[model samples]
Target: MTFPSPKAEAPAQRFQEATAAARTALEQLVAQANEAGWGTEEISVALLEAARFLNEANRKDPDPADDPAISDTPAKEQIGHGELYD
Candidate 1:
């Protein structure tokens, strides 16, 4: 089989890396919010939602040889979906 083009492969690799990074960032955001005593539950929920979205993206097209997976949802949605805050 012909090898996949690097142009197509690079983006996928980047996406996977980004998704992994986002997961870590979301966890930190929740922890920080809790420490600051500012809507800890709300922040935790939002971060959880973001993590889910990222996880889904990672699962959709998991090409380990390619780019990292990342969430495709809007930032606002990740921050506001299914939460007491909104």
Candidate 2:
């Protein structure tokens, strides 16, 4: 099935700019939420829901790693430069 496209197409730089703007807006939302007395659980839940929405929107191809068992299992190796933090 084909998906519908928006009226305007965003270039790579435009997409990057949108990402940065969304990130900044989300950060400000977190700060406001904290000031409004939202706890860690509430904040994290909101963030996770937002992430899920983004994943659903941006997912073009099937990702086999999202299978039940694989998704639930702990990662044996680092992702990207995970060792850099250690």
**TM-score of each model, in listed order:** 0.37, 0.43
Cα misplacement distance, residue 85 of candidate 1 (Å): 39
Q: How displaced is residue 77 in candidate 2, in Å?
A: 56
Query: Which parts of model 1 have CA positions greater than 4 angstroms off?
Result: 1-9, 39-41, 44-86
lDDT string, candidate 1, 19-78, tens digits: 666567666776778788868678877767987998898799677557633454455665
Tens digits of lDDT, candidate 2, 34-77: 99999757997989898898788668535755656634544554
Question: Clashing pairs in model 2?
Answer: none
Against the reference, the lDDT scores of all candidates come to 0.66, 0.67
Error of 1 at 69 (Å): 36
Best by TM-score: 2
TM-score for candidate 2: 0.43
